[model samples]
Target chain A: MYQYSNFDHEFVAQRVAQFRAQVARRLDGSLSEEEFKPLRLMNGLYLQLHAYMLRVAIPYGTLNGRQMDQLATIAERWDKDYGHFTTRQNIQFNWPKLEDVPDILQALADVEMHAIQTSGNTIRNVTADHFAGAAADEIADPRPIAELIRQWSTDHPEFQFLPRKFKIAVTGSPHDRAVTQAHDIGLRMTLQDGLRGFEVIVGGGLGRTPMIGKTLSPFVPLEDILPYLEAVVSTYNLLGRRDNKYKARIKITTHEHGIDDIKHRVETKFVKIKPLFTGEDMHILKEIERHFEPPNFKPAKPPVEAISTTSQPPAFRAWLDTNITPHKVPGYAIVSVSLKKPGATPGDASAAQMRALADIARDFGHDELRISNEQNVILPHVHRADLPQVYHALRQADLATANIGLISDIIACPGMDYCALATARSIPVAQQIATRFHALKLEHDIGPLKLKISGCVNACGHHHVGHIGILGLEKAGVESYQITLGGDAGEEAEIGTHAGPGFGADQIVPAIERLILGYLHLRANETESFLEAYRRLGLAPFKALLYPQEKKAA
Target chain B: MSVTPISKVVTANDLRSGEVIYLRFPHSWTPELSKASVITDDDLAQAGLAFAKGQANVVVGAYLSDVVAEIDGPKASHFRDTFRSTGPSNYRHGKQEI
Candidate 1:
C-alpha cells in the first residue's frame, strides 16, 4: 500500500531512460552481449533457457489494482497469456524478447514498479508479513520500515556486487508468517521499555547450505536499522567467499565465522556508522507510516443472509473455514485467494483472472492485495457482507479454491518449463500431485499441510521449509525427487529432514500418498494437523513409510 | 572450416580505460577493425569513441569460440580467465547493455 513519492517516481523514470538507451545500443550493435549483460541484469532482465525472463519486483508483496492490471497487460502483450507469481512475491515472464524488455520496463515504470534487485547478488525484494498492517497481534506495521529499507537498498552504490543473492524479511507479529528464520537477514519487530525496535536475526538461508538464522541483535532501535543492516551486509560482502558460487551466500559466512564473531563485528561497525542516521531519516519514516494506516471500518456482524441459510453452502463454508482469517478490525476478514487450485499450476494467473481479482478488490475488499510467501493472493480486508459477492466473482475467475494452507496448496517453482536453471519439471509435478490429492478427497482430511516443490537446489519454491518438501533433481537422464519431512513455515520454523532415498518423478505422487497415509496412521487423533503430528512423532514415522521394506524387515 | 575464435569478455569498471575483445566474422569486420591482429590500447579507445558516435557495429550471439584450442593451447590461461568472467558484470539485478 506504499505509494511512490516524487523522488521514487523520478528515480524509476531515470532508470527506465538509462535502460532504454542501453537497449537501443545493444540492438544497434554498438554494444555486444558481453557489454550489455551487466546493464540488463541491473534492470532485472535475464536470458534464461528458452527466452528472456523479466522479473518484476512486487516490493514486500504489496500491489494495488492498477499495478496488478499493468502486470496482466505486460503478460498478455509481451509473453504468454499469463504470468507466474513467485514465492519471493515477484512475477516472472518466461518468454519476452530481449529487444522488448526496455518497453516492458517502461510499462512497469508507469505503475511505479520495476525489476530492480529482483535478481543478482544484491539485496532482493524485501518481503514482510502478508498480514502486516491488518493482523490482530501486530504491535506495529512492518511495511513502512520495509519501504525504508527498499529505498536505502535500491541502487545502493557500494553493495550492488555481493558474493551471492541476499534476502531480508520482516515480521510485525510474534506469529511469524514471513518465514523470517530462513532469510539472510530477518528483522522481527519487538518492543523494549514501550519503545518499538527490532530483533535482528542473520545468516539464515536455504539451498545446499540450509541454516536457521541466529539472533545477532536482541533489540535494534528504528533509527539505527539502515546503518545496522549496512554493517551486517558489509561484513558479509567483504568476508563471504567468492571462490565458489555455491558457498558464497551470507549463510556460509555466518556459519564459518560463527554468529558471535559476526555479531561482534557488526556491532563494532554499527557503533561507528550510527551517527549517519539523522533525525530527518526518522521524520521521513514517520511520513511513510502515514501511507500504511489501516483503512476505516464499521463494526458489523456476519451477514444474516450468509448465516441464515439453514445449512452453510458447502463450497462457501469450506472456503471460509480454510481461506478466511480473523482481522484486526471487528467487521472485516482477511480473505486468502488460493492460487493452488487442483490440477492448475501453482502461483499462475491468467490475465482475465487477474482482472477479476482487481475487480473483487476494488468492489468488496479494500483496494489492496498481497501476494503471500505461500504463493497465494490475499485480499487483506473484506467485509463479511460482501463475502458472497466476492466469493461468486472469485469462483467465476477460478480463484475461489478453498485450499489455502491445505495439502493441495503447494508452492512450486517454474521448473524446466520456464526456468533455465531447472533440472526437472516443477509445475506439472505440482499439478499431478494436486490432482492426486483431489482424487482421494484427502486434502481436507490431511488438514493444513504445507507442500513445497523446487526444480533445483535454488530452493525458490522454499521446499526447504515445507512440511512435505519435494526437491526435483536430475539423475542420469530422468527427473527424480528427494523428499524431506517435518518442515514447518510459521513462527516455529524448522528446515525439513530428508525422509530417505530419492523417488523417480513418476513415483513422486504415489510417494506423497504414502506419506499422507503415514501421517493418518501416526496421528494421535484427527484434531492434530499434519505438521503437529509430524513434529510430535518426528521423521521416523514418515521415514518408515518411505522405506517400507526396511520397516517390515526390522 | 574457417573457424574464427572469439570469446566474450567484460571491460573492467573503468570505461575509458577498459575494452572488451570479441571475435569478428569477416562480414562483421568493419573495414577499420579487420586490420588489427591483437587489439591495441589505441584500437580499444577508438572503438569506445566509435560506439559513442553510434558508428560501432558489434553482434551479440552464442558465438562458437574455439573452445578446445583455447583450453589446450598456449594461451589457455587467457581463454580460461575470459570464459570464467564472461557473465553479468558488477550489475546486481539485471544485465547492463553497455
Candidate 2:
C-alpha cells in the first residue's frame, strides 16, 4: 500500500476542514441547496432516494489491514453497520446522516483515504486490475502507474470540470480483469522490444450508448504516458459536447468525430505537450513504484494430508476450485472473498465481516486487501499452506461461498431500491435470481457465467459486459427487465445483444430460469459455457427460450 | 371537459438527516406518506411544491409526487414514491425500519 506523505496528509486534512466548513454553512442557511449540491457531490456525498450515501475511494482498490479496520469502525460508528462495495471498486455507506458526513470523511482521512474525486465531473478514482501485483500473467504491476495517475489527476486545475465524468482503468494483464474496454480511457500495459508501455484505448463506455474503446495508439512508451494522457483528455475537454448531459461522454465525442479524427487531434496535442514534460512525472512515478514493492514470500506448500481429497470436505474443495486464483508466486494463491452470498445484497459487507477479512489478511496473507471491480474482496497473497485456516475463518464469517464465477455471483447496481437515478429495483431482482439458482443447485454445473443487472441505462453494474445482462427500466409505471446475451468484458470485449422484448419484475426470475435451463440442453457439452453456446447458436434459440409462446405461435 | 387532476403531495429530503419527508398542510413535514397533505387541486399542489422548495434550510430537491387520496390518507401513485415512503426492498432500513 502507498503510505501518505506529509503533503498528501496536509492536502486531505485541508479538504476535510473545507468540507466541514461548507457543511456548517449549509446547515446555518448561508449556502443554499443549489450552491451546496455541487460542493456535497464533489466530496462524494449524495442524497439518494432514502438517505445520504457517502462513497469513499479505495484508490486502485488497495487497502491494508489497519485501513480496513478503520472502515469497519466508521461503518459501525456512523453508518448502518455495513458498507456496500460498488462496481467501481469503491465502498458506499448508505445511511449516513448529512451532519455526520464530514466526520465520516475525517475518519477516512485518518486512514489515508478520502471521498475526493469519487463523484463530480472531475476525473474519478483511477482503478486497475484487482490482482495487479499478484496475478501470474501480469506484464507488470499496474498500481504504481494507477497511483501516479491518481496523484496527477487529484486536483489538476485544468481538468477539474470536464463536460462529463471521466473514468480511466489500467491493467497489467492481457486477460483484462479491470474492464478496460468499457472505460473513457483504458491503458493495457504491454512490452515491445523489452520496453514497457501501454496500449491506450479511448472512448469506451457502458452507459446508454455502450462502446468497446478504440485503440488510439498501439503503444506509448512508459516515459510518455502522462503527457500522452493529458493530450487525450485535453482533446476530449475541448471537443466533448456540453449541449446534452446524455451525450457528453468521450464515447460520444469520439463517435461524432471518428476515431481517426480523434486520434489525429490527440496526436497533435501530444506533440505540442510532449516537449513540456521535463521528466518530473517519471521521477514521481519512480517514487510511487517504491511503495508497491512486493511483500517477502516464504517457500511453503499446502499440507498434503490436510487438503487431500478424501479428508477435506467437498465444500472446501469446491471453494478452492472456484474462489482461489493462481498467484505469480509458486506457493501462494489469490483468494477472492465473495460478498455475493446467496440471497444477500450483492456487494454489502457488515462491519464484523470487514474486520474478519482484515484479521485474515493480517494473519494468513500479506497485510493487504483488494476490492475487485466484480464486487468481491481479494486477499491478494495468501500462502497455499494457510488455505485451510483461511477457509475456516471465512466460513465462520459467512464469506465462504463457492460461487465465484457461477450463476449466483451476480453484479447488481443500487437500483430504485437505493439510487435516485434508478427506474426499477435491481437488488431484489438479483436476489431472486441468485436464490432461484441456488435452490436448483446448478450454478457449478452452469460453469463460468457473468449475470449483471443495472437498475437503469446508466450501466453502473456493467450489464453491457456480462455474459448475461439484465437491464431494468420503467414502462408505464411498471418495472420491466430486458435481457441481453453474449456480452464479455475480457480480452475480446463485446457489447451484449438484446434478446427481444422485456419481462415484468415478477416474471424475470422464471424468465432467467427458462434461459439457463434452456442453455443446459442447447450447449454442445457441459464444458461449453453459456457465452460459447450463445455465440455458436446465436440469439434465435435463446429468444425462443425466453418467450416460448412466441416460438409456439411462430 | 375537465380532466381529473392527479392528486399529489409535496416531497423532499430533510436537509439535516437526508430522510424522505412529505409536506403537511400549512407548514410542517412528516416522514410518513399517510400524514402528508394530498392536494387534488393543481394550483394548490404547485403552491405546496413552491412552499416546500422555499424551505431550503430544512429540505432539498422538493417536488410534487403523484398520489391517490384514500379515506385514511394518501397512497403513492408511482412505485418510486412508494419506495421512498416505505424503503428499499433489499433491506429494512430508512423509513421501513420504523
Candidate 3:
C-alpha cells in the first residue's frame, strides 16, 4: 500500500533506462552472453528450460488495483495469458522475450514496482506478513520496516554481490504467517518496555540443507536494526563460503562457525557499523508508515440470514468458513481469494481473473490487495457486509475454491514443468492430489491441513514448513517424490521430517490419500488437524500410512 | 539395464521469441526438433555444441542434450528434455500449442 516518492520514481526510471540500454546492447551483439547474463540476472531475468522467466517483485506482498491491472495487461500483451505468483510473493512471467523485458520493467516502474534485486546474489525483495496491518494479533505493522529494508538493501554497494542470494522476511504478528523462521534473516516484530523492536532470527533457510533460523538478537530496538543487520550481513559476506555455491548461504556459515561464534563476529562488526547510522532510516520509516495508514472503518456485520446454516448453500458456507478470517477492526474481515481451484495450477491467475480481482479490490475493498506467501490473494480490508458480493465476483472469475488451508489448497512451485532448475514436475502431482482430494469430498472434514510441494530440494513451495510436504526429485533419471510429515509454519514452527524413501511420480497422489485417510483414523477426533494429530502420534504413524506395504513387510 | 551410445542434438531458447529451438546445421535455429542437426558421432556432437554456442546473439543457454535418433529426426531422451521441447504436462501451451 506504500506509494513511491519522487526520489523513488526517479531512481526506478533510471534503473529501467539502464536495463533498456543493456538489453539493446545484448541484442545488438555488442555484449557477449557471459557479460549480459549478470546484467539480465541483476534485473530479474533468467533463461529457463523453455523460455526467459521475468520475476517482477511485489514488495512485502502488497499492491493496488492499478498495479494489478497493469500486471494483467503485461500478462496479456507481452507474455502468456497468465502469470504465476511465487512463494517469494513475486509474479513470474514464463515466456517473455529478452528484448521485451525492458518495456515490461518500464510498465512495472509506472506502477512504482520493479524486478530489481529479484534475482542474482543480491538482497532480494523484503517479504512481510500478508495480514500485516489488519491482523488482530499484530503488535505493529511490519510493512514500514520491510519497506525500510527494501530501500537500504536495494542497490546497496556493500552487500550487492553477497556470497549467496540473501532473503529477509518480517512478521508483525505472534501467529507467524510469514514463515520468518525459514528465511535467511527473519525479523519478528516485538514490543519490549513499550518500545518496538525485532526478534532477529538469523541463518535459517530451506533449500538443499534446510535449517531453522537461530535467534541472533532477540530484541534489537527499531532504531538500531539497520546497523545490527549490516553487521550480521557484513560478517556473512566476509565469512560465508565462496568455494562452493551449495555451501554459500549464511545458514551454512552459521552451521560451520556455530551461532555463538557468528554472534561474536557480528557484535565485533556492529561496533564499527553502529556509528554510521545517522537516524536517516527513521525518517524514511516514518515516510513509509505515512503511506500505509489504514482506511477509516465503518462498522457493520455479516447479514444474519447469510450466516444461517439452514438457508445458505453448503458450498458458499464452506467457503465463508475457510476463506474468511477476522480483521483487526470489528466489522471488517480478511477475505482470502483462493487460487487453488481443484486441478488448477497453484498460484496461477489468468489475466481475466487478475483484472477481476483488481476490479473487486477497487470497487469493494478500498483498492488494497495482498499476495500471501501461501499463494493466495487477500482482500485485507473487506467489510463483512461486502462478503457476499466479493464471493460472487470471485465465483464468477473461477477464483472461489473454498479450499484455503484445506487438503486441496496445495502450494506448488512451477517445477520441472517449467523451471530449468527443477529435477521433477511439481504441478502435475499437485493437480492430481488436489483433484483426488476434491473427488473424495473429505477436505472440509479433514480441515486446516497444509500440503506443499517443491520441484527440487530448493524449497520454493515452502514444502519444509507444510504439515505434509512432498519434494519431487530425479532418481535414476525418473521422477520420484519424497514425503515429509508434521512441518508447521506458525508461532510453533518445525521442519517436517523425511518419512521414508521416495515414491514414484504415479504413486504420489495415492500415497498422499493413504496418508490423509490414515490420519483420519489416527486422530483423537476431527477437531485435531493433520499437524496436531501428527504431533500427538509422531512420524511413525504417518510414515507407516504413506508406505503401508513396506511398513507391513518390515 | 544396459545402454548404448545414443544420438544427441544441441538446443537453446531463441533470444527474441524465447521459444525453444534446436540447432540446425549451416547456421539456423528451428522450433521443430525434426529439423535439428542430429549428431551420431561424439566429435560432431561437441562440434554442434560449439556451433550452437556461437549462435549466442540469436539464442541463450546453448548446450548439448541427449536425443534418440529417429527416422524423421532426434527425439528427447529424457522426460525433462521432452517437457522442455514440448511444454508443460499440466497445460497445453508453448510448443505444445498445436
Candidate 4:
C-alpha cells in the first residue's frame, strides 16, 4: 500500500526513459552484450535456458488491483500468457524477447512498478511479511519501513556492487512470517523500553551454504535504522570475501569472523554515520507512512450468514486451517491463494487468472493484493460477507484448491523449466507430489505439512525451510532428488535434515508416498502434525522406511 | 562435443515496442552467456534498474544456431548448450566503463 510521491514517480519515469534509450543503443550495435549484461541484471532481467526472464519486484510483497492488472497485461502482451511468482515475493516472465524488454519496463513504470534490484549483486528486493499490516499479531506495519529502505537503496551508488547479492527481510510481529532468520539482514520490529525498536539479525542465508543469522544488535532504535543498516552493509561490503562468489555473501562473512566481531564493527560504523541522519530522512519516513496508513476501516461484526460450520468439509476445512488467517480487523480475513495445486506449475498464473484476481481484489477484497513467499497470491482484506462469492470466483479460475498448508502447498522454483542453473526439473516434481497427495486424500489426514522443492542449491523454492524438503540435482545425466525432513518456515523455523541418499527422478514420487505412509504408521494418533511427529520420532523411523536394506546391512 | 545451440537474450530495460525478432528455448534462455547479445546498451545495463519507456520487457532475440527438435508445445526446443557455454561468450561485464 506504499504510494509513490511525485518525486518518486518522476524518478521512476526518468529511469524508464533512460533505460529505453540504452536499449535502443545496444540494438543499434553501439553496445555489446558484455557492456549490457550488468546493466540488464540491475533491472532484474536474466537470460536463462529458454528466454529472457524479467523479475519484477513485489517490494515486501504488496500490490493493489491496478498493479495486478498491469502484471496481467504484461504477461498477455509481452511474453508468454503466464507469469511465475517467486520465493522472494517477485514475479518472473519466463519468455520474452530481448528487444521487447525495454518496452515491458516502460509498461511497468506506467503502473508505478519496475524490475529494479530484483537481481544482481545490489541490495535485492527487500521482502517482509506478506500479511504485514493485516496480520492480527503484528505490532505495526513493516511496509512503511520496507518502502523507506526501497527508496534509500534505489540506485544507491555506494552498495551497488557488493561482494554478492544482499537480501533484507522485515517482520513486524513476534512470529516471523518474513523468514527473518534466513536473510542477509533481518529486522524484527519489537518493543524496547516501551518504545518500538528492532532486533537486528545479520548474515542469515540459504544456498550452497545455509546459516541461521546471529543477533547483531539486540535492539536498535527506530530513528537509527537507516544509518545502522548502512553501517552493516558497508562494513560487509568492505570485509566480505570477494574471491569466491559462493563465499562472498555476508552470511559467510558473519560465519568466518563471528557475529560478535561483526557487531562491534557495525556499531563503530553506526557511530560514525549517526550524525548523517537528518530530520529530512525522518520526514521522508513520515511521508511514506502516509502512503501505508490503513485505509478507512469500518467496524463490522462477523457476517452472520457465513461461518465455517463444517468441521469436515475437507477442502473447506483445509482452506480455513491453512490458507485463511485471523485478520487484525473483525469480520475480515486474509485469503492466501495456493499455487501448489496438483499438475500446476508453482507460482504460475495465467493472464486470464490474473485478470480474475484483479477483479476479485477490486470487488470482494480491499483492492489490496500480495504475492506470498510460498508462491501464492493473497487477498489481504476480504470481508466475511464476500467469502462465498470470492470462493466461487476463485473456483471458476481453478484457484479454489483448498490445500494451503498441506503437503500439496509446496514451494518450487522454476527449476529446469527456466533457470539456467537448474540441474533437473522441479515444478514437474512438485506437481506430481501435489497430484498424488490430492488423489490419496491424505492431505488433511497428514495434517499441516510443507513440502518444498528446489531445482538446485539456490533456495529459490525455499526448500531450506520446508517440513519436508526435496532438492533436485543431476547425477550422470540423470535427475535425482534428495529429501530433507523437519524444516519449518514459520516462527519456530528450522532447516530440514537430509534423509539417507538420493532418489532417482523416477523414484522420488513413490519415495515421498512411502515417507508419508511411514509418518502415518509412526504418528501418535492423528492429532500431531507431520513436523511434530518427525520431531518426536526423529529420522530413524522414516529412514527405516526409505532404506530398509541399508539399515539391515548396518 | 557437438556445438550447442545458442540464443540471444535482452532485459526488459533493453527492449522496445514494435516488430522485433527474438528467440526462445523450451522454457528459459541460455546461461549468463552463450550466444547472448546486449544488442543495446540498455539491455546490458537494465538489471537492478527500472524500465525507461515501456512496462519493462525482459526478452531474448536469437535465431536457432542449430535446428532444434521440439520436445514441448509451441515453438520451443529442449536443446541446451553445455557448461562450456558459461558466461557471455562474446560479452564481458564492465565493458561499458562509466
Best by DockQ: 2
**lDDT of the structure predicted as candidate 2:** 0.94
Give per-candidate clash totals: 18, 0, 0, 70
lDDT of 2 at A507: 95
Each model's fraction of native contacts: 0.08, 0.94, 0.81, 0.04
**Residue A226 Cα positional deviation in candidate 1, in Å, after optimal superposition:** 2.0
Positional deviation of B53 in candidate 1, in angstroms? 26
lDDT of 1 at B47: 58
* Cα deviation of A369, candidate 1, in Å: 0.7
Q: List the residue pairs that clash in candidate 2.
A: none
Q: In model 1, what is chain B's TM-score?
A: 0.21
* Alpha-carbon shift of residue A331 in model 3 (angstroms): 0.6
Docking quality of model 1: it rates as: incorrect
Per-prediction DockQ comes to: 0.06, 0.91, 0.79, 0.06
Q: Which order, best to worst by TM-score?
A: 2, 3, 4, 1
True contacts kept of 2: 0.94
- Compare candidates 2 and 3 on DockQ and give the better one: 2
Local error of candidate 4 at residue A467 (angstroms): 1.1
Superposed by TM-score, candidate 3 places the C-alpha of residue A33 at a distance from the truth, in angstroms, of: 0.5
- Candidate 3 per-residue lDDT over residues A309-388, each given as its tens digit: 65767777888889988889887889999999999999999999999999999888999999999899999998877777
